[model samples]
Target: MAGGAAHRRPLAGALAALAALSACSLFVGVGALSPRMLLDEPDAVALMLASRLPRTLAVLLAGSGLAIAGLVMQTMARNRFVEPSTAGTMQGAALGILLVTILAPGASILAKAAAATATALATTSLFLAMIHRLPPTQPFLVPLFGLVYGGVIGAGVTYVAWQADLLQLIEIWLNGEFSGVLRGRYELLWLTAACVALTWWVADRLTIMSLGREASVGLGVDYAGMLRVGLVIVSGVSALTVVVVGAIPFVGLVVPALVSRLAGDNLRSTIPLVGLCGAMLVLVCDMAGRLLRYPYEIPVGTVLGVVGALAFLAILHAGPRHG
Candidate 1:
């Protein structure tokens, strides 16, 4: 109770900062719009509505979705270091997207998202089964196998992309960048928002399932059923995020972990906060990418990739201390 009370002010401050940063994000793009004219000028209104609004929405949805997915992945794996990336889920989704591009060239965005989600869920289930079969004492083996598995799939996709003569397009698909987002193209992210809502709805069940399969079953929960539901939701969210903002690696891993640190591991209470933190991180990184180079823009994905890698190392160094 005392801890939750202490977090109130800090959490409020974080929310305000995120909201302010997201507002600024709407005006910081490569356009002539000014904050003052956001509502008054027709041209500014048009640009804000047609471009910035949807982009902003996409950022929120995708950020929240990935954060929730990370939260679930870490909880289920019982390892703070684990996430969709470490579990081979995102790699599987990427491979699915690549396969779609090859098999059904010029497929609709919805089709691609569906393929990615299905592949991610399937791969995560396989990884989980493999890990579950291992002795409980050998916990590290699961993540190690997952890491190597994801690497192999990633390498395979890269090779295929190189051979397809569509390497550039495929590369663009994985490189997290929100710059290319526009009204029609970004509607796909709404699916991510929907997934976030669903996560909240199932938050309590997920929390119980995270307690270990035996505990969950002991508590009258359908352990396998709950796990599948959680993973499917996570995969769908992650895949849509990848489709929208490319791969903002570690947002899911970092944001939810940070939230759990400050707010405790109550998934029911932490969902929105994780989302806000994720949005703030991406918004900050995106602005930094734009401002650092001025005329020469660096993609938000690249900046995040570099920063995420450093953060991942820091988390590794910090070890279970942070957890």
Candidate 2:
């Protein structure tokens, strides 16, 4: 009972902090809709509804969803260094988006996202299949192979985009930013959030899944089914984020890895923390992007790229720890 209470306290505090950040996010744009103006000014209400609220929500959903995907990838692969970006998921999604642009220039965002999701799933499945063959004793090999594989897939995407005259268009999906997010535009991210939430229901099964297939079956877990579910969740989340706000790289890798250090890998207990921590980290990065250049803004992906790289190096310096 005491242990549960202790855990709840940190979650509570994190939630409170997120609430504060969300409020701050509401007022951070160049248009400057102050809290005082919101009480009486009609334009403030319009700005809040049309722009601020949606951007905040998109940021929250993307951050949390990416983190959850990363955790699921780590669990399934039993590797700390793998996530959507490192595992070919994002590259696959980008290819899908490019092909859709070439084949269906007038496609809706939903169609593009659908295509991206399908390709992302295929690529992630391919990566997993390749990783599964490597000796489990050599943990470093999984992420290394994943990196090489993702690079090959990414190269294919780049070459095809160049051939099709879609390099500029592809560039938009390559780096994630939320400046254009509006109420109607960013709603699809809710689907990603939903997929992540669903994982909580089967958290125990996933925990057992990390033990590998034969062992998972011995422990009464349906390893193949869970792996499929994880892949779908990871691919869907990655594709949706790419489609909606471009790719928020490394949120998945950075957040889950750090959270596991504190909360350990019991998904039931750590899932909430992982999501909250990810949201917080991303919100901070988004705000920094807005503030660092003042009126001008940087992409959240660019901000996170630098930050994630540093964090990635730090994590590596700390040495690889099993999830």
Candidate 3:
């Protein structure tokens, strides 16, 4: 009971902090909003509903989805460092977006999202295949290989964008920001919520798969099928995030690492906490971006990159256990 209380305390604290940050996010913008204004001013109400509310929702959904995606990837790959951005999934999505832009200039948003999801899945599969080819003892090599593979994919996308005069569009996708997330604009991110729920439902299978193929098979688990499903979840979340708010790096990588440190690796128990921690991290970063320049804003992706890189380095320095 004491141990349970201890666990709930931190979860409660995180939730409280998230709620406070969310409230601040709703009120802290160029157009000031206050309790009084919400009741008295029509513009305040409209802005809150149309912009601030959507942005906050986007932050929560994107953060939670990416963090869950990271946990899934880490468990499946049995590597702590591997996540969507580092594993080329984001770049693949970018390539998909670029292809859609060039090939079907009039493509609908759903079509673009489908293309991105397909490409992300393909690239993630390639990364997994490469990992399978290498010795299992050198787990670090997987993330390193993913970094290089993603860079190659990114370079290809950049070259194509440059040639096609679509660099601006690609740039927007690369630098993730929620400033553009108004009501209709950010509805796609709700898909991430559904994905996260689906992931939660399969947490037990994922946990089993993380125990390695022999262990999974010993327990009568279909290791290959579970791996495929995990990959699909990661790819879908990554592609949706890229298509909706651009590539917000490091949330997946950093949030899961932090959550594991606080809550341990029991995915069934920790998935909710992982989602909350991820949402909190992104919310804090987004708030910081808004405050940094007042009227102007730094991209949330930029803030998270600097912060996530530092945290990632610290994790590396600590030499996380593979377990």
Candidate that beats the other on TM-score, 1 or 3, i.e. the better one: 3
Better of 2 and 3 by lDDT: 2
In the range 1-323, model 2's lDDT, one tens digit per residue, is: 12287578889999999999999999998997898999989999999999999999999999999999999999988888888999999999998999899999999999999999999999999899888889877777877887788889888988998998778777789899999899899998999878887888888889888777888999988888999999999999999999999988888998889888877788888899899988998999999999999999999999999999899889878987553
lDDT per residue for candidate 1 within 1-323, as digits (tens), equals 12365656766887899888888888876787787896688888889988888887777777777888888888777767778877888888887888898999889888999999999898888877777676656655666787898788778878988888777765676677777888898888888778888888888888888777888888998987888788888799878877666777788888877777777777877777887788788778877887788756788778878887788777666667633
Give the alpha carbon lDDT tens digit for every residue of 1-323 in model 3.
12376577888888898889888889988888897899999998999999999999999999999999999988877888889999999999999999999999999888898999999999999888787787777767877888999999999999999999999998888879999999998888888888899888888888888888999999999999998889889999999899999999999998898888877777877888899999999999999999999889999999999999999889877875763
TM-score, per-candidate, Cα-based: 0.92, 0.97, 0.97
Q: What is the lDDT of residue 174 in candidate 3?
A: 83
Full candidate order by lDDT, most accurate first: 2, 3, 1
Clashing pairs in 2: none
Per-residue lDDT of 9 in model 1: 76
Error in Å for residue 180 of model 3: 0.7
Q: Which 10 successive residues of model 3 have the least lDDT summed?
A: 1-10
Model 2 stretches with alpha carbons more than 4 Å out: 1-3
Residue 53 of model 1, lDDT score: 82
Score candidate 3 by TM-score against the native. 0.97
